[model samples]
Target: MSGSRKYVRHLSTLVTFSVATLVVAACAPTSAPSGAVAQNNHTDSVLTVGLPGSLSTLDVAHEAGILNYYVAQVSSEGLLGVDTEGKIVPALAEKWKTTDGRTWVFTLREGAKFQDGTQVTTDDVLFSLDIARDPERSPSTAVYWAEGTQVEKTGEREITITLPEPSVNFDWTVTASGGLWITSRAFYEAAQSYGSSSDLIMGTGPYRAVEFQADSHATFERVDTWWGKTNEKAPKKIEFDFFSDESTRLLAQQSGKLDISLQIPASQQPQYEALSNTQVTTVTDRSYVGLTFDTAVAPFDDIHVRRAIAYAVDRNSIVSSVLNGKGEVATSIESPEQLGSHIGVESARSLIAQNLADIQTASFDMEAARAELAQSVVPQGFSAELLYPTSIPELGTAALAIAENLKSLGIELTVTGKPVEQWITTLGTGEYGLSYMSYTPTTGDPAEITGWLLGESNPARYSQSDVRQLITEQAGEVDDAARATKILEATKIALNDVIYSPIWWGKNTTAFASRVLHPEINSYFFMSGWASQIGLTDSQN
Candidate 1:
């Protein structure tokens, strides 16, 4: 592991539902407004966005969802913010440095103030971090900060964090998406319930939340006193309206009621593209969707049984047909974009391809599946249940396909769907034999998702000392190339062990009205004030 200030900075930087019913209205073209009224509407400094899901809470620590993060980012901020290119940049903390990769020091920017007109002090930062790291307060995020880690104010405008061990990618843990959003301690302690509809969270971001209606909509207005550079073309007011139904969202887009719409279903991409005055953009995102097995279970505990199911499922067919050619078949759990963060993308791609070339990947073959099953302890058939969230219908479809394929090998697979909350609880309790896992990477670090899947706390209950050692080494390895190599090695081990079968990597499609200039849509864009990048087109302006 190389030790250098510039190298550390560079390395650190590198780190649904529904449908139907209203289809007829979605297909129908909306009536066009008069030219004069349209021009005025397009030029107005108000941006209305249609989100595919509802926001459950403004306090991401209480209940964190993609939508919740998206909304929280509008007004709140973290110590660091990820740029569109996935590099860690300054936010509340203007500058940061780590000499030994174990202890990090950050210098706060001058004149930073919260939305409530309170000066941001070192006490506020300490208080916020303490709350974020508390297990009871932030159950979903407390894992990022280990028990022995320590944080203290070293100066008036500087804070120091010492991790339990040397971690090259520890900086990512303080990012907005990484779950350490900062808030004023004064406002937080006074509020009866912070981040609620009545007492919305306060922060030092460019926007201030004015209204929040649970599972309905939220509104924000630009703050004139923000310390950071403000975009002249940024919208003065931004609104997020939740549309749980895809068709209804499509209808809203078609009717010109939304300036921007996100998470367009792959099946409805053509429909969204065909809409008038809309520009549809799609990109391969850093999200992993796959099948995980509870290795503690009898049949799944047998490696041969796991390999048999892996060989039987046709991943290519699922990506092409079920995903409508919107995504690619995943050969590994971590996304290529993440692994490529330290090195160039092309180099990382070649490295992964070359390293895993000799490993036996589970391809779709009935004979191979039968042979593997025959070698398992349960040579005969065994019945087990596979569970997925009801919100994601594609997972259910893919589960059915896998169940059908496994039938030929005397395996009786039962596919079941539960509500999102129930599905999460079921997974936490390890109540299912097999399950579907859909994870969105919070940081650019390659270890983010893999650390959870292959780490000691993995839900699969599968353990490999070699893989765990590699993961531990990579976390503290300062050299970019060395860290990437170790990650790939662990990936190979996990893939061969068949603890989790790779499915399809996801693609996100967002539609913007023609009058609105398209914003940079990337994996980390949502972690910052991304909407500020949206502006009126030349013609509209």
Candidate 2:
């Protein structure tokens, strides 16, 4: 790991589903707006966004979906905010530094106030961080910021954090998600209620929530007294209307009722591009769609069995048919493009190319796969079930392909498709033998995702002491050279272990009406919380 290249930590983890398990009603929309209005047609200053699902909650601690984060980003300010380039930027904290590797100090900005007009102070920061760190209080945040950490008010506008151990990701965790969003202690204690139907959440953000209707809709109005930059006509109001169906969301965009729409299926991208009034922004996310083998299970417990499946699956064919050639065949579980890892895509490719000469042009070697399977405990493969969620068609399709390939190897693979909720429950309880999963990078550091896979609670029940130690060391190793070395060692071990087989890295697409002009749109931090920067164009471009 050299300082010359950014060491990227992609939060894009093994799961792409909204972390929130909010159940959405199945009732279809009764009506939709008319066809797209002309680009020059100036309507009200409201920006109607077609959300893929209803928001679960306004409270960051309660929900992990990007939709809720969208609301939180507008309605609250964290100690830090993620810029479009995936860089951590100052939000409430104007500057932060560390005197010792285990301790950090943050200086708050002057004159910052919450949406309710309450002044933000060091006490509020302490309160918010404490809750975020407590497992019983905020499960979503506890994973990012470890519990038992100490916080002290060092000055009127400064606070200090003392970690039990040196953690390079401490600041990244604070800035990674809305969970670190600073909230008024007075308001939370008095209200004792947040993320309800009434949408009574307060923060020091650029917008304030005015209306929230569960999974139906939520609306926010710009904060006139916001401490951030804004324009009078630049989306004075932003409304998120949940449309669970992709077709309905597409219709909303085409009908001009939606100024922005997210997570549009890739198969429909061509149709959307043909529309004259829509502008689509896309990136091949660091997220990977793959299969996780439960190492605790009999067959997968054998490394030979795992390697057999990896060799049998035709990743190129899946990318071509399922992903429509919009993805890259994953060479490793971690996205090759992670810059924060110091060894970026170019470096990764060069290294992989050098180490594995045949990787550059490899094909499915069924014979090789069969040989590996023969080395397993069961030379004659046994029947097993492979699970996938119906929400992502690509996963199911790829699983089907893998099933077909496995059949030739004397393996009776049963592919099971479940709805998002049931699938999540099944995974949580370890009810399946094999699974096709997705991973999304949530932070600028690779350790977040890498460390998670190696964590004790990993659903796959896969662990190797040597690899685990390497990943654990890389987590707190601030020295770039040492961290990179540890990451490489762990990655090599993981590759050899073959605990999981990666298929492809999918592209994330966001479509907006032609009139919208967003200067920088990124896959990181996703499409949430852009109301303050979204501007309007006089003509379609």
- State the weakest 10-residue window (summed lDDT) of model 2: 1-10
Root-mean-square deviation of each candidate, in angstroms?
A: 8.5, 7.6
Candidate 1's C-alpha runs over 4 A off are 1-44, 358-361, 377-380, 410-422, 536-541
In model 1, residue pairs whose N, Cα or C atoms come closer than 3 Å (at least 3 residues apart or on different chains), thus clashing, are 15-445
Question: What are the TM-scores, per candidate, against the unseen true structure?
Answer: 0.87, 0.84
Q: By TM-score, how accurate is candidate 1?
A: 0.87
* Residue 387, candidate 1: alpha-carbon lDDT: 73
Candidate 2 wrong stretches, greater than 4 Å? 1-43, 66-71, 176-179, 190-193, 198-200, 339-344, 352-363, 371-391, 410-428, 479-482, 525-529, 537-541
Measured by TM-score, the strongest candidate is 1
Over 1-541, each residue of candidate 1 has an lDDT whose tens digit, in order, gives: 0000000000011010000011010011223222322222433777788875555567767654455566666778888876666667788888898988799998887888998788899899999999888878765556667668899999989999998878888777787766588999988898888888899888888889899887688999888767765545667888899775778888887777787887677778899888766777887666677777888877788888888988888999998987898777877766677678788677777777877765464577888889889999988879988876544556778889989998888999899875443354454346776767676565677777677677765657768999989988888998888888888899789888888887876776778776565345665665455755556543322
Residue-pair clashes, model 2: 27
Q: 394-486 in candidate 2: lDDT tens per residue?
A: 676788888899998889988876543235445424666576556555556655455555555555777789987787677678676567557
Residue 512 accuracy (lDDT) in model 2: 73
